[model samples]
Target: MRANSAAAVLLLLACSAAATAEAGGGPAVAAMFVFGDSLVDAGNNNGLVTLAKADYSPYGVDFPSGATGRFCNGGTVADHLGELLGLPLIPPYNGRFSVGSSPFCGVNYASAGSGILGDSGKLFGALFPMERQIQNFQRTVEEMRARMGESTEEFLSRSLFLICAGSNDYINNYLLPLSDKPKAYSGAAYAKLLVRRFGIQLESLYWSGGRRFLIAGLGPLGCMPSQIGAGNSSGCVDATNRLAQLFNANLRSILRRLNDSLRDARFLYWDTYSTSSDVINNFSLYGFRYPHLACCGVGRERGKFACPPLLPLECGNRSEFIFWDPFHPTDAFNAIAARRAFDGRLQRRSPMNVRELVQLPLRHQ
Candidate 1:
């Protein structure tokens, strides 16, 4: 079952005192600002003219509002995190925030198909690249300062900034034969390019007052049903998985460097790859029966396309499936992952878990 609001509140409140003490006596997590791609996107892609969207039926069949552009079958990692933080679901920065939005709980700047590089998602369509997302965040900070007259820096320092990107850089750019990226750059070169850009982005955020960061690493893209279907193989694609590992290694190094340089900042790396692969390899252990196929979609592996509308070909037992669509995890999996991030001691999330991250005493540089 999902972690409800009350459960999340209870969980966080129990540690709130400790967190307050740790942060040199400051407020508990004030807000959670999210950035990156679709894995954490709430509904940022709803109005976008991109093919990478999930604002339709069977996408949110289990959610209360239904199809809020979330790629998952229900709430996303952001939603689960919000509930854990005792805050309402984080709103997308595009639609609602475009017209005088509030950053009370937080704002989600993640857009489906976005990448670390501006041109990464260009081949797919007009998606919000990481640059644009950061621009939006700057706009948000300005707006908050103008309206609330509050100390934006202080507020942001206590907030949690979550980042989850890099998948599309490989999935849509480096791996797509039609794209010229691969021809222009080798896999190793591409990874370096992405990491350099990512560093700039994070550095920009730090300059903008962001201090608490939870950066999620790339997941096992090779194991996605789409890749599995494309290869017609019984297992995941090794080549693509290697790309993810390379990027993850660089990311860990980046975090270490950022932590060392930005003395006041706390950067925690969430190992999405390891956590997800665990579920994929041990589906039955995680109460999932189908790890290789999506509950929605149709084809040799039921992953050639997105889930159709009106529930056609949709699985009734969505909870039993690890993947909801061709390329996204179901709400069940997202919940499990989110909860683990909140308190799990697994090696996937290190230095300190999300719970410890929230309670960390504020440090000013």
Candidate 2:
């Protein structure tokens, strides 16, 4: 049953890709470089010795290739965005596609459990922090320079840098009972720290010739199944949501500052919190029957642990669920979010959306 559903979705995606290509004529941007955590991770964690991994079954039941290490059941938000941009799926930095040659369409440096802060996901073991991911991108730049020479600069400048991070910093670090972060800093202070660190990371990318950035703000972390389960709350936890809101506010201010100060750089922000809240609040309108429960997992709301390798039980209709596991959204939801981020209005994607961002004239340096 799941296989049939996956095949149907695959066919639909192929048709959509073909139609999108025919309409756009070609790829919208030179490439799309992705950075962030599990939400956009395209199997980077599969090579790492980490507890935070989703390389097994029931994980990618909806994807044609099956569990390729993406957290969703099928295509991730990044994968969908790549298709919408008329580009092929962006390969993970640690994967075989990135090993022998430079992917001109860009590479994904995101890893599961990674965060803005270096020590945010220390408990997960062997994950790439934002700084390390930037270092990896630097390596890619050097590779591109060797192959394309000075042309690499223009190539990257015209490309899009899509980033979606910061959830783990709060969920796995500051809010964890065993973590020391909560002890040392208040919620507001921690958010400020994250924003400052995030700014430095973006600057590092800018220095590396990246000019177009679409940074996704943290979603309502308090509304995730894990948070609800942890707090034993029937509804979203207000305190956790407040912390996320604080970080998002700071994130927007920093991006605006960067856009104003940096030359030839356009730092567009995506309001994931508000967008996600709307979807959850009006799940029926979006075809979601289980907005707050996991499609696959065990325990209360099936949000206690990550989906196990051997399926104890799984939802028959994955497309109807917003969440695939305890911590990640389903492929259906990923597609919706990607579409919104690609062409949403000012309220969702500030200043401009990805479509507009790609259309902006590149100022040669």
Candidate 3:
């Protein structure tokens, strides 16, 4: 999309969302910039050619307005992140919505099944690389500026950058071994690759004027519904979870080093692994009826498909449910996750918390 056209569209969407939030007696989110996979995907893949697309049935069934391409029934972590930041949830940078019904705070550039690398095979004959997502973010900002003018600064600076990705590289790409090594990079190699690629891609944002960032680490890829279903048809695979730990560990180190190297970069880590694990570890505590079993979808594990597609029972209340589908979290899960992430509990990992990381005022680019 042309930069101006994209901006105009965002301006309209933002205004619409703002109107709705005001009516609801809720405060509008300052602004938002998102990058990730299905976990935070609002609707980027809807336009792109990919089986990972969620525009179809049951994906947005739980959304406030119903069926918004959020991958799950309702909202996503990105939307909840905006709420935590004291703003309204945003939608896809590409998805269309009415003025009165939009992710008001900002737009989502996340794509389902997209990875940190374009190596997730061709989506619609084209790859949705992290670089492309970042570029889209820049375009989003440009669109906002055209509409709000000076208000754009506050929205951009105060806005949060929700970046979630890496699972695809491990799950869809290289986690599996083969004769020709077909599909994806090796697990260990993909970790380093993600770190490096993440650094480069995020640097583009930093230099382009983004300051505060909320980057999510890789979740338990092996433990995902698809992975666990690989052969076991059960929830929570030990080896896959271990690989998650490896990725998370490397991610922890990378975040620290990136902060050190960037000096002024005020970035925060959204440890989806821990946050995700917290749910699995304490499902009963969270009011989950089935922690190991997916609330929606088909098969024991490997046969799992979209939730709405299945004729199985639906949880009475999703807020207390754990896994929404085979590979994603439910809307209620995101609501709580936003609370945890904003409360500073979920993002608390090794070296220091996100608050401590962004402590140094960004003085230089």
Name the 10 consecutive residues with the lowest summed lDDT in model 3.
Answer: 351-360
Q: Provide TM-scores for the models.
A: 0.89, 0.90, 0.82
Q: Over the stretch 1-365, how does candidate 2's per-residue lDDT look in tens digits?
A: 22322232233233333444553543347778899999999898998899988899878888988999999889999999898987777778787652223223667889999999988788989999899889888877766666557766766776789999999899888988888888899988998999999999999999999999999998888878887877667889999999999999999899889988898888988988888999999999999998789888877878898888986546888889988888899889989998998888744444468888887765543
Cα lDDT of model 3 by residue, 59-171, tens digit: 67677676666777778877776665555556566656444443455667777777776766443354466778877767766766666677565345544567887777666
How many steric overlaps are in each model, in order? 4, 0, 13
**Candidate 1, residue 158: CA error in Å?**
1.0
198-289 in candidate 1: lDDT tens per residue?
99999999988799898999999999998998885888999999999989989888888998898678888888899999999999999999
Q: Give me the runs in candidate 1 sitting further than 4 Å from their true place.
A: 1-25, 97-103, 346-351
Better of 2 and 3 by TM-score: 2
Model 2, runs deviating above 4 Å: 1-28, 98-104, 347-351, 363-365
Per-candidate local distance difference test: 0.79, 0.82, 0.65
- CA lDDT, candidate 2, residue 130: 91
Indicate the residue-level lDDT of 257 in model 3: 78
Q: Of the candidates shown, which would achieve the greatest TM-score relative to the real structure?
A: 2
For lDDT, candidate 1 versus 3, the one ahead is 1
Candidate 3 global TM-score: 0.82
